[model samples]
Target: MTVSRTRRAWIAGLMLALAGGLTPARADEPVTVFAAASLKNALDEASAAWTQETAKTTRISYAGSNALAKQIEAGAPADLFVSADLAWMDYAEKNGTIRSETRVNLLRNAIVLVAPKGSTQKVALEPGVDLAKALAGGRLAMGNVEAVPAGKYGKAALEKLGAWDGVRTQVAQAENVRAALLLVARGEAPLGIVYATDAASEPGVEVVATFPEGSHPPIVYPAALTKESRNADAAAFLTYLRSPAARPFFERQGFGVIGTEKRS
Candidate 1:
């Protein structure tokens, strides 16, 4: 039997969940979250806090927004989804994978160029900055520009700054922003483009420069409950993320709070 790509993706996600020790959720089971990889640190902290306060546990799976959205569409039993961009959230909404009425813009972020901690690279992100010359025959690490939000945003910024043509051939694409960040952090690539929050979370990498505002689409994180979720606490967990209780966790990681605020 030939497996369709969508079905294959669904199977893969199910396998991963089972491998991670997840079972069919019951009312007593933890809230399952499929979140963008960039949200790991902040979300982890916020969710832990929520657990401390409510005694309700959570199980979160992190990946690129595109991959997560596809997994959700493929029938992964995730209770909540937080996407790195509006497009992916829109994708999930359009496919009826999420409860559209529960959707809201949750956070904002910025992109930046980064280098390994010991590297002495300084860049001014502007028109004609000669990004290719700065690479000095090395690769520019980034997420898969075609399918990943970070890569698309990075590509747009580079194009806007007139640097895309110069460094087009030297690009090294990764599966996600964190993987791209690892390339630079491990000194595999002299430079990488990632979210400001990602750079902040990795001590091995240092920000070289921030992309100018308006260079790319505004970075927004939209979140919602999955359509199939039946966990009684899922809605509360989603609300907690927008509450004042969760704002500091996100802010400490350099993410801006912009969701409809909820009372603690």
Candidate 2:
């Protein structure tokens, strides 16, 4: 979609929501959200609509959701938490950081292969490419699989294809998704594995392929309100997250809509 039309759609949606009293909150007070870095672009755009529709500000902090979940588990101040997967959300909910009923699937994404700009080397999809040769000029970038959801998905998919142990020792891990993307963008790494949305941010990178959907458990995002939040605006923000105003932005970023509709 054209950037202008996307912007106009956002503005029109916000205006319509406000006129229809869909969102109602005070602008001076903001809801604080801890979100996965993979959502950086889409959420930034969607959050603006929530702000305008409700007259409430949303202050978002992006990072590996697992790290943020650990912080929240250790008492971080946040009105809401949006996790890249259910594991982290389950951790928070189990620890009493987030209300159980508030936890709901938001979106899903897939793992994709991307290489630096102007690189002609194409990654062969047979049992994973030979890392040392395929990424001959630089390290292949990926998030730390221990905690980054994108990395976890990548690893799981690789493991399913019987290539994990073979490539494990040759890996170059980054702190988070964005760092991995940067590795490829700056030519520090010849290729990187990040969410489809994360790769969309850099014209310097191009996706070579996507892991088959059946390769790993679906990559799903979940959001929830926390009991520690005293902000009255938090509920309004959560509601806006599931609205039509935010749906297309998720699609524009290549995220699958999370609902009863399954991929057929």
Please tell me which predicted candidate would have the highest TM-score against the true structure: 1
Candidate 1 C-alpha lDDT tens digits along 138-218: 999999999899999999999999999999899999999999999999999999999999999999999999999899999
All candidates: CA RMSD (Å) = 10.3, 11.0
Q: What TM-score would each prediction reach against the true structure?
A: 0.89, 0.85
The regions of model 1 sitting more than 4 angstroms off are: 1-25, 261-264
lDDT of 2 by residue, 43-162 (tens): 898898777776678889999988999888888889899999888888888888898877778898888888988888776655655655676656668899888888888888778877
Which residue pairs collide in model 2, if any? Answer: none
Clash list (residue pairs), candidate 1? none
* Candidate 1, poorest ten consecutive residues by summed lDDT: 19-28
State each model's CA lDDT, in order: 0.93, 0.82
RMSD of 1: 10.3
